[model samples]
Target: MQVKKADGSDYEPNTISAFQRSIQRYLEEKSNLSILKDKEFDSSRTAIAAKRKSLVQSGKGNKPHATKFLTYEDEEALFSSGQFRDHNPEVLQRTLWWYMSLHIGFHARDERHKLC
Candidate 1:
């Protein structure tokens, strides 16, 4: 199907195949569940599945960020600064810590939660 471009500038070619595949996988995984036997259970399960599929199909899923990923140059520049070294004598230790932290992804969403 054709839909508006993600950038919102003009029409573009798009398809619902990704969403459909996610739902199909969910149904296959839960094929043993009887929808007719339990109304409450089935409804709740379906709701959760749909929510998960929606999150995956959208860019809001629980995966790594595409843009703004750190590069080797950025990491080196951050750790090699003299100001940062002056505060901490354990230069190597802190450098390794920052490297691992960046590799694993950050817990803070912004500067407000940074020190926390």
Candidate 2:
């Protein structure tokens, strides 16, 4: 599968690993920024803590679970009816945005704890 970066760059190889590395780098930068901005430290730390608690409560933090993917039949139906592409575009977009946001947030929290 091909992965597209936010900057419109395309990368081939292991997309999961690439995304992980990108999140790591982002977290590192965020951590450095947090360290320099002592005034915002508490707020940032609290936000991270809340997210950590949420993930734990949801049974998704550091636990092995089945990764959900769109099935071939689902994809075919979506493409054929154009439901996901048109009628529910907002839902699809929002879902993707949330997924990326949560992934990045959790990854950043992990990196912050590691650094600490």
Candidate 3:
């Protein structure tokens, strides 16, 4: 709870929860206490839960928006529009790259550097 991001902002609820889990694991491995199951840790668990709820209410830790997939008709339209044409080498290369990335489950932000 005392830690913050480099920009001095609070960590997201998911990150905080992960930190909590790590602490619990460490304590369990090194000591006899179990934050998850110990009655003594009930107040600590409640505090963490409340913090997570507060962060979520403030629009943090929400899932990312789902990526929209192209319908069959949309794909056909793109093909018809010459965007995915076999005749144009540049367009064909781009189309292949796009489809290959999707098929390989490469996230643009996470895998772009590795691919490049």
Candidate 4:
């Protein structure tokens, strides 16, 4: 199963793996067949595995990016800017966000609906 991008280019190995898993899940749900284990799909399974390995070797797999976090100086700057104060509603909300991010693991990427 050769999955391609919108531009007709090849998908990354990780993306291909995800697509394979999704197809495997659909097959299991509708036909009670396991593509990962069934003998009928041995060639297909090997092809996907070999393709993924080749893509990974060519650096088309997942890569880690540098993580960003508030430094001590950044925290000091925020405190000096008076944004952490609870007197004003806007500042209070920001303060609450900062505190929740630090204490309750509420990062910027967290869905807002999860807070409710």
RMSD of each: 11.1, 18.3, 5.2, 3.9
Which residue runs does candidate 3 get wrong by more than 4 Å?
1-3, 65-94, 97-116
**Can you tell me which runs of candidate 1 are displaced by over 4 Å?**
1-40, 64-70, 83-93, 96-116
Estimate, for each residue in 1-116, the C-alpha lDDT of model 1 and write its tens digit: 22234775322112233444566567669885433345646664565556556646664444353457667787567757642344666765665556566666666657325633
> If scored against the real structure, what TM-score would every candidate get?
0.34, 0.26, 0.59, 0.63
Per-residue CA lDDT of model 2 for 40-109, tens digit only, reads: 5566445545554654565544434434566789657765765444457685674565455546654545
Q: Report residue 41 deviation for candidate 1 (angstroms).
A: 0.8
TM-score of 4: 0.63
- The reply for model 4, stretches above 4 Å from the true place, is 63-67, 74-88, 106-112
Whose TM-score is higher: candidate 3's or candidate 4's? Answer: 4
Per-residue lDDT tens digits for candidate 3, residues 13-32, read 98888988899889988999
TM-score of 2: 0.26
Evaluation by TM-score, superior candidate among 1 and 2: 1
Instruction: Report, for all candidates in order, the number of backbone clashes.
Output: 0, 0, 0, 0
Residue-by-residue lDDT tens digits, candidate 4, 36-101: 889998998899989889878877765655356889999989888896878899899888877876
Q: Quick one: how many clashes does candidate 2 have?
A: 0
* C-alpha lDDT of candidate 3 relative to the true structure: 0.83
Say which candidate scores most in lDDT. Answer: 3
Runs off by more than 4 Å, candidate 2? 1-32, 35-37, 65-116
Lowest-sum lDDT 10-residue window in model 2 = 9-18
Scanning candidate 3 in windows of ten residues, the lowest lDDT window is 107-116
